[model samples]
Target: MPASISMDENMGFQYGVSRPGLNPPIQFGNGFYGAGSGLIRGGLGAYGKKICGSSSQYVQSNISKYFSDPQYYFQVNSHYVGNKLKIILFPFLHRGHWTRMTEPVGGRLSYNPPITDIHAPDLYIPFMTFATYLVLAGISLGLSGKFSPEAINWQFVKGMVGWLLQVMLLKASLSSLGGGEAPLLDMIAYTGYTFTGLCVAVLGRITLSYAYYLIIIWTSMCSGIFLAKTIKITLYAEINSYDANMHHYLLLAFPRNSNPKPRDSQNRRETISLIQKCKQFHQVPPIHAKIIRYFQVQDPFVVFELLRLCSNLNSIDHATKIFQQIQTPNVYLYTALINGFVSTGFCLDAIRVYCRMDNESVSPDNYAVTSVLKACGFGLALEEGRGVHAQVLKLGLSSNRSVRMKLLNLYGKCGEFEHARRVFDEMPDRDVVASTVMITSFADYGLIEEAIGVFNRARSKDTVC
Candidate 1:
């Protein structure tokens, strides 16, 4: 205590300034209070030692459900053979709408072949093809005068081992990313499909020796495409990436001692959950800061989610700002931004983004094509819309149902009924959406009688949009 200082109201606690002719106290009092508080905490801890044990067990018990969440379980059913082959051959045609049955059913389709399923795992095709491949290999070996029982057996084992290695690689990669609860059998089913492509490649090798290389290349590409599409639809979205930000530098120093397994997954889930909450709880600036703190903004999934939330919240300006923050945006991220702009009635902005994406040499997906087409219709950029239609044709996306629907509606809305009618007539499978779009186009172009005919022909008109 200073001799010149007093605890009276007139001589209050002087902090920074020199009181009239008064010397300041040497003690700050903070350290003394802190020491007293530490002693009190220590005393309490010592006293509670007998009653309280380490809380690690308590926390382990409390959070067991989070680690064992049912949502993380990757279920599989593979009791079908026929339609499963169709799925492996052409996944792009998968409409992705599974049918449901209420009463007890009796067929393989009932258990394994979901009516409109896109990515369900199946074993029948792959296993049968593997056996057929062995037979084909034996035949080839016999024809080439290299046939031996031991050699044939070795070839079969080698193929199976290779398949197992592929399964293990995919499983390990997916598991580290918070997926791979899918069963070993489910993975075997997936990896074994490669044999079907191999069987075809062998036939080509036997029939046309010089063209075998072309056949091999084509079959390899198809196999790659099949695997990519299946994994994208089924497992890719289920996985989440860990944060690799510099904030974990200390954790890096003491690796094993500081970091726990599931630490990254927990952090990822928490960060995404926080970002989701920001659409409701925080304004754009705080949310932006939170995002920068938590995630890689350029990650397509994170960008997509943020853009989606911003659009849902009607914050198109914030989405634009976020889109600008991306360094090298991919097609999906660009589509998200374009969708936000188009959905909020910023048609010109959507078109501008589409152009920017084009100049970046990024090819748009079906969603982007449909979205930009709608934007063109709304903006009444008829020539620009026609140019996009030509681009769609050149890109081979003219066959896409959504793209067709958008093109027809765009033409009709711009008073080009002939183009709309051509688009409608060219559809190979004229379903409910196509029919509805045709009707709308006809009405927009003052063809009421044609609209009525389309309305009468449309089946299941419930989901016209």
Candidate 2:
């Protein structure tokens, strides 16, 4: 028989005393409690395991999404390391393309890694250099008879702090400079590059002692130059509005030298020399402007140099004014002005300059023709490009490889695939580059099948395709 049970206020359950004719009261055993608790514990453990696993995966995915793939930054090879080191120490000497290489993957453009592209940033050098810096500091401490584990640990801490500060500073700078959307890993890699120069400075201090000052200054200068140039090309490439101002900042950062007088009497030689010097030093355009104003130089050669410099600086207006100063512009001077306008992205102005040259009866050279063709391509001036092509044939430049290539590019960019194909067929030497260009142009216009046909029919094939 069951025992009579009543609820108690303090205790959850209480067994009442057995009444007459009632069977012995049932006992509440420990097994009951143990089984009940075990059920709850097992359920909770399974739930908690599932929650932890899902939450950890969520956090990891979020981190990866925010920071990008860290593996991309660490993919460096020996050749890439060597070239990267060279760039860090002598940025001005690097003449290769500053933009990263991209390939089509899953129908989207993905940038190649440092192993495949020299322009792509990496983390390997910076990490190694930081370690080297710490080691060098330890060596210095040993030389001074102050070596200790505590001292080495402190150095490590300090180095880490400095690295963090540099990263923060670079991230902030880029944010304010209109590159806030840049990847976090890229910023880290770029800022870490400072350690390379830091390592060099420490080594110099340990070795030379006396020239430590000089070495530090030089290394600092090189590092500044490297960062400025790299940021200029990589981050600022698309910020057209900020490009001129960025050039100004870079101009200020470059080292200065005393001005030199023009060498010859006519000042043509000296004027050209001065322009070259300014170009080399990255002197401000105003300095050249002042020179042009003071010297009142009129030589076509000097004017051409001035136009070239202005073009390089993307100052097409200044280049136009310089061109106006030439009363009777020669072919070279016209070509220089056209090239400047083309380079500065003033495609319409370049076309107008080409027209003006034609009106002035200045014959277009191969360079002038090519520059005008490029301008037409960029401006999408199909009719203008056709006119330039006619001029090319009339001037007997059709056989010129560069001219032919420009013609092919102009037609392809304008979506004139038939013309482009005709030009390709007529090419006496359809090398890999020309064929690749044709195939790429077709592919760009969504002619994948055509591209494949061109590839199959090609006389020679290479990996570049």
Candidate 3:
């Protein structure tokens, strides 16, 4: 008989294989197992269960936040539809406020429903307008004696293509101009407003074909004006909060449509406040002369903020001078300076800063490591990347996800897939993102089968993978 096994109440098992001799009594229980085929299935099953349970929980928590609930976009009423249509067709005539209404709920400000807020976006009008366009197109075709199922299908396809182009153009424009974090569905709704104008233009063509050109142009202008106003309002709502001084400065520097006229006393006060804020600064070195002179600021954190701003403005030289004024910089300051260099396409300068931080005996954190690794990847500095990898190991940051991902990215960009694979394999829990990265690396290098193999071996797969 096989060795008698005693199962404890706590799921532990004691094997009586060691009967005074052979192999010093094999033991298989409490998460430790001796070499044996009998316990293989049970151990594998237990491990698989733990992994799947954790993976399921993790995916549920993370993925849910990414995809928005569509129900919010569809909550509409007839009054909203009427008001929304008017705004789309005649936006300039709109006398009401453009700001979205909000209400307090659960200690946070939540936007009011579309039924009550005229400025709020909804899918109801878009869907109705799209259907009306399709119907009108069918009628126009029938009137022209060219009506066919295929023609309707083609018109539908055309309309969809136009809608997609609108969305893509709007999204791309927002990305280029920055500060438009409108939801994907909101973009869809905004773009879909074009269909409302299209419906009227199509109706005009069906009724009075001779005046089609005039009608189309008029509708186009109206649509353009409406969209400009709507998108401007949307962008304005997405502005992040800033300190009062920064807010006043921005208003004075770049007045908006809603900015109070400079003739008003209140507006004058705001301008004066901004000037006073600027007057607080003392004259510094010519290198850090421009904005730094206006803000008499010596705090390293403030300098870091200005450094980021200068980088955004493509004034890296000014940022460097400001950085030099700091007597001692922390990891955040170092990371900011490195990031500024990286953003401004000065990868070598970023690497030098990282090295300088190291030379100063300041222990670099994961953020600094990731920033330099990005510089290495962009500059294709394999040797420098390897040195950073060594530092990562020494600093015990090899286990950090961001650090590892950056290292993997650095190696892959430098055509060092072998090292990338080694880094990938060392990860204890390879999530979808890590697997996707490995697969992408393999595919990029023409290793098709290797990419498929990595995908197949992934314990958890998601749409992203």
Which candidate number has the best TM-score? 2
- For residues 62-116, what per-residue lDDT tens digits would candidate 1 score against the true structure? 2442243222112333433445555555545556422222111110011122333
Q: For residues 86-155, what per-residue lDDT tens digits would candidate 3 score against the true structure? A: 8888878999556566442221224566877788778888889899999999999999899999999999
lDDT of 2 by residue, 1-465 (tens): 111111111111111211243233221222122322332332334433543565476556546643765777788889999999999988888885566664422212245789998878888888899899899999999998999999999999998898889878877776685543556666677778888888888888888899888988888898899888777666554233223334244444433333534434555666667777663212434445444444433556777888787666555544654555466779898888778766654454565566666655778889888888887676656666766787777779899898888888888877889899899999988888888888889999999999988888785454344
Poorest 10 consecutive residues by lDDT, candidate 3? 1-10
* Model 1, TM vs. native: 0.41
Model 3 spans > 4 angstroms off: 1-68, 105-107, 239-465
By TM-score: ranked, best first: 2, 3, 1
Steric clashes per prediction: 0, 0, 2
lDDT agreement with native, every candidate: 0.59, 0.66, 0.64
Model 2 TM: 0.42
Cα RMSD (angstroms) for every candidate in the order listed: 27.1, 28.1, 22.9
lDDT of 1: 0.59
Inter-residue clash pairs, candidate 2: none
Please, what is the TM-score per model? 0.41, 0.42, 0.42
Greater-lDDT candidate between 1 and 2: 2
